[model samples]
Target: VLCKIACMSRSRFYQSFKQKLDCTPLALQQQLRIENAAERLKAGESVSQVCFSLGYANLSHFNRRFQAQFNMPPSLYSRKNISH
Candidate 1:
């Protein structure tokens, strides 16, 4: 869809996107989702809520991705960031 919008072939779009962003589109998308999840978690949302709301079907997969980005699990991140 983005390739079509950009009027570029799939390979060309990927190459251009990587050259400009320094990462694949999927990586950037995951990073954005995790960042959004962190914000939602800090706002006192539950882990399961954040996971599923962000279209993550598997809790463990969401945990792994969140941990990779933040160096902590979503639960711990919420505990540390949420206001008492």
Candidate 2:
């Protein structure tokens, strides 16, 4: 469904998407989830709750990926830039 919506071949999409977006399909989803977490963090939501809400079975993994993408940790981004 997502592939169809994206109007791309599975293989081509995999390569191009990674090259353009810097992540796989699922990784992109997780990245969005990380952004959502960042928003919630700014809203004074707890990291643990955000992790669970994002359906992450491994909170540590989520943190690692989120940190890897955005430089600082999700919690830090929320704490520092909540107003923005």
Candidate 3:
């Protein structure tokens, strides 16, 4: 859909996107999702809520991705960052 909107083929769009952003579109999307999840978690949302709401079907997968981005799992991040 983005490729169509950009008036470029999929490969061309991927090449241009990578050249401009220094990352693949999927990587950017995952980063955005994890960032959003971090904000929601810091706001006191539960780990399961954040995971499923962000379209993550598996809690472990979400945890892995969250850990990869933030150096901690979502539960730990929330516990550390949430206001008392």
Candidate 4:
């Protein structure tokens, strides 16, 4: 079981995983969105649309975290995606 293997009660496991992974369950689910967002950006989805689709309630927070993880702004990642 996820809780047992994770070595915590269900609530504690969820909380611990969230802190460890830097995101909630839904947010982790939307890591799939991050992958898709990157791909869609490569194929030419606008950044704002990607932001919304990824459920970024705050566009600025999305941009900040994306930049933090990838070491460049999403726009630049998009451009780089185009080049590569």
Residue 42, candidate 1: C-alpha displacement in angstroms: 0.6
What's the C-alpha lDDT at position 82 in model 1? 99
What's the lDDT for residue 24 in model 1?
90
Q: What TM-score does candidate 2 reach?
A: 0.68
TM-score of each: 0.96, 0.68, 0.96, 0.61
Best by TM-score: 1
lDDT of 3 by residue, 1-84 (tens): 999999999999999999999999999999999999999999999999999999999999999999999999899899999976
**Can you tell me which runs of candidate 3 are displaced by over 4 Å?**
none
RMSD (CA, Å), each prediction: 0.9, 2.9, 0.9, 4.5
Residue-by-residue lDDT tens digits, candidate 2, 1-84: 766778987887789888998879887787787888888888878888888888888888988978988898777876887664
Q: After TM-score superposition, what is the CA distance of residue 57 in candidate 4 from its true location, in Å?
A: 2.0
Once superposed on the true structure, which residue ranges of model 2 sit more than 4 Å away at CA? 4-9, 12-23, 82-84
Alpha-carbon runs more than 4 Å astray in model 1: none
lDDT for 13 (candidate 3): 100
Model 1: per-residue Cα lDDT over 1-84, one tens digit each = 899999999999999999999999999999999999999999999999999999999999999999999999999999999966
How high is the lDDT of residue 8 in model 1? 100
Better of 2 and 3 by TM-score: 3
Between the candidate structures 1 and 2, which one is better when assessed by lDDT? 1
Residue-level lDDT for 68 in candidate 2: 89
